[model samples]
Target: MIKTIIFDFGDVFINLDKHATEKELLKLGLPSITEDLEYINESYETGKITTIDFINYYQKLLPDVSEKKIIDAWNSILKDFPKHRLKFIQKLSENKTYLLILLSNTNELHIDWIKENVPFYNNFKSCFNFFYLSHEINLRKPNHDIFRFVLDNHQLNPVETLFIDDTFVNTNTAQELGINIWNNDPKKEDITNLFTIKSNLF
Candidate 1:
């Protein structure tokens, strides 16, 4: 029997852009996805850098871009959160048959947006016993170490864990570690209105 339910934050619960941020960044003449920006983002999330310092770094790199504009663009990936999914999660949590957990690779900027916009964010957090993030854990998905960290730290039985994520490589890696996985391809797999377990939830 499945003992734990693990969910990915971006696509599993909240809607995320397929490539909107990179597209918007590209429009800003930053074609290479700036190592500086990525570093500052990851670093900030891990507590290696402060939010103000990260903002300053971005400002230093893109002198012409306003701080507000850059921040807005950075958070633009958070487009929507379907209410039906929330209802489903609520229903599942109400059942209380499994240990509910969340594992997501997210940065500070996105989190700030969630705090500001999602009124149910606190309730969602309360529904899970464990909520892990790449930045906080200093490990990211698609990396075996992170998956191992989650499983070992939680004392989870791989066979009894079902991990849901939007990224194929992430799901692929978890599957390799013996955890049942679901690759939630939005174009092919619509989880927004899910109620019952389907053959292809994976």
Candidate 2:
């Protein structure tokens, strides 16, 4: 039986253009998505660097790109948070059937943008029994340690926990830790259909 539910914030809840950031960066004169750039992004997501340092790195690399422009480009990947999804989560929270947890691999800037843009951000956050953000926790998904931390922190049994994420890499890691997983495809899968789609697990 599933006693706890862990959800990913990105595609699973809010829609993301995943490629929008890269496209916007290209427009802002980023030559290509290099390994070094990926490293810097991951470092920022892991809270190894400050927001100023992140923007400074971009400024130094793309000298012509303004700080505001770089920030915009970086945040372009974020899109809308549909009301239906919020309602779904809200209903789930009201029922109080399972221990609801939100686990997201996100940086500070993106979160700040969400808080500013998403009108019901605080209400959505309150739906979760516990909310864990990567930068705030110094941990990101696809890392075994993060999965362990969540489980250990809640004293949750892996066999009775279900982790839903849009990323296969993250779900794969959670599965290895013996948790149930739904490696959802955002293009075709809507998280509101959780029970219908994965009924056998329940």
Top of the candidates by TM-score = 2
Clash count (model 1, backbone only) = 0
lDDT of 1 at 57: 79
Give me the displacement of residue 18 in model 2, in angstroms: 0.8
* lDDT minimum window of 10 residues, candidate 1: 193-202
lDDT, each prediction: 0.80, 0.96
Q: Which stretches of candidate 1 lie over 4 Å from their true place?
A: 34-41, 44-47, 192-202
lDDT of model 2, residue 130 = 100
Across 15-109, the per-residue lDDT of candidate 2 in tens digits comes to: 99999999999998888999999999999999999999999999988999789999999999999999999999999999999999999999999
Residue 18: error of model 1 in Å? 3.1
Residue runs of model 2 more than 4 Å from their true location after superposition: none
lDDT of 2: 0.96
| Per-model TM against the reference | 0.88, 0.98
Q: Write the per-residue lDDT of candidate 1 for residues 42-63, one digit (tens) a residue.
A: 6776667766887787677678
